[model samples]
Target: MKIDKGISLTKVELDRIEANFLAAWTGDNSTPFIVDAPISASLRTRGTAIVRQTNLYTLFQLCPTLATWAVLTPLAIDYGASNKNVYSHISVFTNKNFDDAQAREKLKERFRFAARRIGLPVVGNQPTELFFAPLGPARSQLPDMARAFVGAALHLGPPAVEDTPSARDWQRRAVATRCPNLTRLNATISFDRSAYCARRFEAWRRGNEPLTEAEALLFAAYDQAVIGFGRHRSDLVAPPRLFWNGFTLALEAEPSQSAQSIKLGPFPTQLPGGSQVAIRTPWPEKITWTAGSIAQDIEVAPASDEILVFDADSGVLLTRTALETKVIAVASERQVVIASEQFGVTSFGPSIQSADPGRFIAWTITGDELNFPGRLPPWDHITSRDGALDQCRLDRPRRNAYSFGVGWRVDPQNRSRCRRPNQNSPRTIR
Candidate 1:
């Protein structure tokens, strides 16, 4: 009964069986395998292709992070530059690629994001003309494509577009938001001088005669865009106003300076003590003012530093030292409590005759010398209703005072001289 041993299945036969079984279970050409993954392998392959084949402009549209690498790669390979001191390439790429008016105007939205990331300086007045020559023939007309492009840009902040249109749009939005800090894109692009000069003269009744060529150019461009309406006479020609109608202009003059009559367009309710006005100086650009030559005083400096304090006469820089630097206000039966950095705190009562400084009142103080490891300073101390000087005192002088603990470092040269808060007052948590 030794029948011929059954022939073993050949490799081809085995493969055929496996294939047939798979087909029967899942259908031969059934929906192509689509295994879900975090990142699609197909997309990765496409992105690799884009990196190799895409142009510089298109590359930006696809991947903005490439901007860093693109500039780096060239300088690294050709100029032997390193990331530490390779600002030249960064500047060039940013200026040349991002600042092109025509390029930006086309991809305005994308350009806006790029400008923000790179921090472009602000130019006033003239609209940014991104394209020198039209992408198509109709340069003067606002094409549907351009409008759609702007709409799309507004929708997709950074991930979508990569041109000047985006940048200008962003700037407009920022200005509308009343954000004081603004940087311009394409700073090298000059402004329209005629429009700028006209607008400046209208506003201040003075010409920018002393402006340098560069400054003049920038101002000119800003005026043209903001005021000229890009050679059109439409309703959008005027620059956005920064003031509110019927707003009161208040003034509290310092005693040292003479009482001078102030003039603005239309006068609202007169500021009782004195109307507040801004005196802008030309050199170093300072602003200082006084109430009726003998009233309360406040002065802002050339460096834009401001000091608000009570003054019989704005004659000298007042300095008052206190036990705790954070004292704010003093309270008395008849007089109101007042606080100033220089005067500490004072209670002004009708009966009390002499003008004198008083005891420490409640206020907030920041501990500059507090060595807190892995922690930020108590900046939000102002939120505390009861004014308390936020001081950082140590429990054990040797333990937390000198060193904030295991993960702290004081300069080796000045380690001995470093002063730590003594155990007199404990670190106030509030």
Candidate 2:
């Protein structure tokens, strides 16, 4: 398909995708780890995870900040540069299994009509539909599961579902209809087909035990994760936990000597009598797990000795949210994360009700939404003022220095300001 147009559709697609990329510069030592920020074009973000000769998983973690455009632009070019005639990149997620050819064609027609209305091409490229095969006998659906997660990153806004009573009711029914158990995995220690690694991993995850084998591996070759698009992470020395006093969602951890992050549930559940909560990989850290029935798994490193807050409100993993609460710091080994005053796990668990045994993956829900499915995405809350892409900006201003307070940017001048990298926003996060 050749066209005499003002600009190539490929260029249009790249602009649209990059428009949603949110980034900001931080204070003096704000984001020291993103040292390659200036050279993201040459950044190698993906890796092969293997042992001996076994390819377990493909691991990649790319931040969505301005620097990341170096990586995305080429991929967009390649995709659009393909045999033109259809918008193969756009896809829909569904778990339905079609049985009849007639039904399939009808659905295809309907799908294409929707696509056309949205200005997408009708044919000549990859298949338009992405099917999430239902869990067969032993949960043979990791690839499908991973695709849902990766696909999820492409969308913005609440699902068409509303907060009305009927929506909540149906969502409740859906939740009750159990999805199969997430395959249990032990990426670390004594893992063999007959390794009993799952049982041992659970034991250690719940109750610390004296280990006889080599220190359990922190992650497995099958493990993989991607953190970006406004998400952030920090390390903590203590165990990660979500406890609630009703007034606020509280995170408390003790000081630990170990210098690594702890792995918590990719599984979700909240505390006793508290707002819905779950453990996630602390920010900046990413891992993909063959054992994960969901998107990715996290290991909280223990070096920083400060616990960071993660926002599950939007349903995206490890993204940032406003730290509106108070933090309190106490004596050695004892810390309270209330409100700086800045910053700062628990078991592999459900902390679940006894009545529900079949569910391994509990979702993150809000207090007022009444146990409905998750609404906000990790990046959805980030809104551009002009109601388009790239315009989303978070500008944080001055907080006094020396307090170790409100520092999140870097600049050429006072270096106290933060601005969205690629987007045209003067706002900074400090």
Candidate 3:
């Protein structure tokens, strides 16, 4: 069999090759001597069992030099089962007790030279490094002989050469080729829609181009909905106010030049078993009040420009002040009386029980009467108009003090009349 150019195996070498093949096939573990024969022919004769045994040692022994063995190992394995045992054995045995760094450098040089000999591109410094050691998993590197064979078969083509352009450069080129008019200048890539619009607006401003119809609509909608008209103005015509009603007016108060300083009197004496309390101005404005508590019914009476909160039973004054304020009187088992000028109040306490949960009344007097300047509806005839109110028109006496018509009325004919079940008895309204 022809092993290389101008080299032919004699009868003795072919006999030795067949003997090693039969020995390995019969499971002989003895180290078989090498024979000068084509690895392909030996593989066909012995099958994959050649590499699974010590037959690879026979092939390496027969080869003239490591270079020849390197170029033929992969070919033999490819013709066999492509099992890694042969390659692994080659790596360990050849490099045993050898300097790893020096051996690696030599193998790399030889592999590159052999690849170039086969018309492969040997570009850049250490181009062999791509397929050599450290590129794949550790211990993946085969012996010098095995690497030379596999490298030639696997990487001996133009496709194996590393291309010059980066992935980003190729992607940009592809986009430009597909859409020639697309410009990336001053463009911002963002996941946020607001940021995208802002970037688009800035780009349009820098380019000095008229806004597209879609861009104009986007800007107008964003400005009117998210950014109020007072703070931001869009270049496009303002969007029509679809829900604007004349009754809903936006009122902006003028900033006060100076805040009024309110002086408060001493707190009223605490009741027995009362808890210690601390009160401070709810706002940054300098205002103080006399902290106090009261039991029994409390009455808030407005006199001229001043307001007074006093106990109705004893007629003792609790607070006398003039300010837009709110009063909260807790009439539960434990009473907590608080009067504050703050617009909002937050309270905490144990849940209270009531026979009629909806009968409880808490009123807020904001000093402004909410008036609809129009003729009022006839609430007495509401049952005739709305079927839902028919059940409420029973002739029986109203048991709930909070039932309709007690504190509400409709002056449909510009006349008001109080309705009481027993007006002659002089019932007191609480």
lDDT of 1 by residue, 1-430 (tens): 1111333434453344333322321232111110101122454343333334444454354343333233333332323234422334433543344345565344444433432232122122232232111011111211221232222222322110111122334334423243222111111112111122122222221233423222343334434443332321121111111110111112333222223332232432223223344322221111222223212112122111111112222222122212122221211111121222222221221122112222111211222222112222244221122323332211121111111112122222223322333444433331
lDDT of 2 at 22: 22
**For model 2, how does the per-residue alpha-carbon lDDT over 237-293 read when each residue is reduced to its tens digit?**
112333322223333332323222323355433222213333332322322221112
Model 2 misses residue 158 by how many Å? 25
**lDDT of candidate model 1 versus the reference:** 0.25
Report model 2's TM-score to 2 decimal places. 0.17
TM-score of 3: 0.16
Model 3: per-residue lDDT, tens digit, 91-169?
A: 5433322236675455445545543332222333342232221111111211221222122212210010011111122
The C-alpha TM-scores of every prediction are 0.22, 0.17, 0.16
**Candidate 1, run of 10 with poorest lDDT:** 29-38
Q: In candidate 1, how many Å is residue 142 off?
A: 22
Q: What is the C-alpha lDDT of each candidate?
A: 0.25, 0.23, 0.25
Query: Which stretches of model 2 miss by more than 4 angstroms?
Result: 1-106, 112-125, 128-139, 142-239, 242-250, 253-430
Error of 3 at 170 (Å): 11
